[model samples]
Target: MCDYTQREYSCGHFRWIASKWCREYTLTHKRCQPNVTHFEYRADEPCGECKPKEYPPWENLIRRNKQATY
Candidate 1:
């Protein structure tokens, strides 16, 4: 399983990022900083702080793609 977590920004943006690796350094040092793989305005529940904006066609595509994965 992948080690990761979801974080919510003050701007009402949600992002999925790496958490930690299980194994120690072996052959090569490949430590990676927490990286954001996805980002989007919360659609299920709107936040008043950021007052969500409508998704454009491209962003809608991203939203749909993200939905498909999970």
Candidate 2:
């Protein structure tokens, strides 16, 4: 079995990173398959997909034409 590192984000999302390769080889190209075992690690920040997006300050500006009277 291969070894991997699992990262847990604050947003409750997780990701796996391969750390070692297994002795088993693929049937097609004969390459080592790293697909088993994992070690857990905690992260203080949220994942990229879960983070809030920031918009430019100019986007919130309101423009008014002097000729237009309400």
Q: What is the C-alpha lDDT of each candidate?
A: 0.54, 0.69
Candidate 2, lDDT over the whole model: 0.69
lDDT top scorer: 2
Q: Worst 10-residue stretch by lDDT in candidate 1?
A: 20-29
lDDT of 2 by residue, 18-67 (tens): 77655563334454544647656566788879889987798669675769
Task: Show the colliding residue pairs in model 1.
Answer: none
Question: Which pairs of residues have clashing backbones in candidate 2?
Answer: none
* Residue-by-residue lDDT tens digits, candidate 1, 1-70: 3355676765666656565553542334565454444444444654455666766667745434435553
Q: Model 1: runs farther than 4 Å from truth? A: 21-70
TM-score of each: 0.28, 0.46
Residue-pair clashes per prediction, in order, are 0, 0
